[model samples]
Each structure stands twice: as structure tokens, then as C-alpha cells.
Target: MRITTKGQVTIPEEIREAAGFGPGTEVDFVIGDDGLVRVIPSDRLRGERAASLQGAISRLRGSADVALPTDEIMALTRE
Candidate 1:
């Protein structure tokens, strides 16, 4: 996939599913010694259990109080 005119690129669905990436998911890029960049789920990196991917997704659902509307969330992904 190509980056848009705004330098935005869509993550593949399978990668998103595998990485527990949903709207509002916080991610950081990890450049390894292998010269590959990995998109890491910030929650897991922050000491949240690696098996608790759903927990991160659920938090984005407003369980903790600050849920954004779908359009607003999608707009962020484009940026």
C-alpha cells in the first residue's frame, strides 16, 4: 500500500489483528539490529501482560472514561 498525499498509510488488517491494534491503540516503532522496524503495542511495552491485548482494546472503548467517536479516531490514524 502507498502512503497517501498526506504521508498516511493504512496498516494491513491482518497485522492490525495480530498486533491488537484498534482505534486509539498506542504504538511505537522498534528498529531492531536486524534492520527491521516493528510496530509494538505500547500497552505491552508498558508492563501490561503480553496476553492481555484485549485489555488495551477495551480501554479504548471508554471503560476508563475518555472514548472518542469513530470518525475522530479514524482521523487520527490518517495523521
Candidate 2:
């Protein structure tokens, strides 16, 4: 396959389908010392679905008996 002047090449349809590449799917490019390039799916970085943190801190609400320093509490609140 040849890269056009725009630095783009049409990935063969068969290869794309077999690799499950699709619109909006993220991929990575790795270059070996031998000048070989490989395409890998980004999902490999995430082992599994992640849990939502929306309610993870719900338990901390109204649980503080002692007051913390304003600066320290503000730092934690930012996250």
C-alpha cells in the first residue's frame, strides 16, 4: 500500500474488518527498530469496564465529625 502525499493510506477493508476497526475506534501505532509498524486497538490498555465513581464518595457525605483544615479539605474537594 502506498501513502499519499497527504500521509494517508486506505487501510484494506478486509484487514479493517478482521481487526474490528471502525468509526470512532481508537488505535495505536508502534514502530519497531526494524522499521516495522503495527496497529493495535486501544481497548488493550483497559482490561475491563470500569466502575463509575459517581456514588463512590457518597459515603463521605456528612460523615466528618472533626473539621479539617480549609486548605486540605479544598484540595480533596477539587477531585
Candidate 3:
């Protein structure tokens, strides 16, 4: 199938059905390490976002040196 000037290509009905891509389904395009592109549905997007957030939390887990309480932190921020 040809992509239009808008970079849009229609996926075949059979493939769409197999992939559970019904009308109005939210999708994301992912490029793999093997240089292959994949169409991922939104249901999987939540897991991906959670994993990314977990990674960030892990990286910042012990980076905070200050032990200020919530009110003190808020006061510092206001100053």
C-alpha cells in the first residue's frame, strides 16, 4: 500500500482485525533494535509508561541528600 502525502497508509482489514485494531483505537508506533517498526495499541502503552516511571524512580531513589519535612520543603520552595 502507498503512503499518502500526509504519511498515512491504510492497514488491511484482516491485519487490523487480527491485531484488535478496531475503529477509534489509539495506537503507537515503536521502532525495535532490529530496525523494525511495530504498531502497539494503547492498552500496552500504560505498561510502557509505568516501566519508564519505575526506571526513573529507581535512578533517583537515593539521590536526595536533604531530609527536610514536607512543610520545610514547601517553605524553601516559596523562598
Candidate 4:
């Protein structure tokens, strides 16, 4: 398994299947604290980020209790 001139190495079919990597799959390379590199699906990271964003949004929900309508807010801003 040699890296191409473009620094691209093909993952073996077995590894790809085991890792659930299909064609057009987006992957991320992570270096562990133990000095091991791993390839992970980008959606996995997105899922974590989505969860974090959901939590943040949930916390902020209802925090903005505005009584003004859109037009009124726009008018105030314009003024």
C-alpha cells in the first residue's frame, strides 16, 4: 500500500467495508493522544456537533421573550 504522489492512499476493500466507508463517503483523519491516526466518517463528527448545537439551542429557547412584532422591531431599528 503506497501513497500516490498526491498523498492519497487507497483503503483496502476489507478495511473500507469494516469501517463502513462507501464511495463518496466523507472522512476525517484524527491523531489520538497515543500517537495513532484513525479515519472516521465526517457525519460522526457532524452528529456530535449537531447534538452540541441542539443543546445550546435548547438552553437559549424561550430566553428571548420579545413582545414586539417584526414590523415594530424593524421600525425601531430603522429609526
Top TM-score hit: 3
Comparison by lDDT, 2 against 4, better one: 4
lDDT at position 31, candidate 2: 84
lDDT of 4 by residue, 1-79 (tens): 9989999999999999999999999999889999999999999989988999999999999886779889998999998
Q: Mind giving the per-residue lDDT tens digits that candidate 1 earns over 38-76?
A: 889886566656547777787677554668899988898
The models' CA-based lDDT, in order, is 0.81, 0.77, 0.95, 0.94
Pick the lDDT winner.
3
- Candidate 1, residue 71: CA error in Å? 58
- Span of 10 residues, lowest total lDDT, candidate 3: 39-48
Better of 3 and 4 by lDDT: 3
Q: List the residue pairs that clash in candidate 2.
A: none
Q: Candidate 2, residues 19-52: lDDT per residue as tens digits? A: 9999887877778799999887877534322333
Better of 2 and 3 by lDDT: 3
Task: Give the per-residue Cα lDDT of candidate 4 at 18.
Answer: 97
Residue-level lDDT of model 3, residues 1-79, one tens digit each, is: 9999999999999999999999999999999999999999977988989999999999999998989999999999999
Per-model TM-score versus the true fold: 0.50, 0.49, 0.69, 0.62
lDDT ranking, high to low: 3, 4, 1, 2
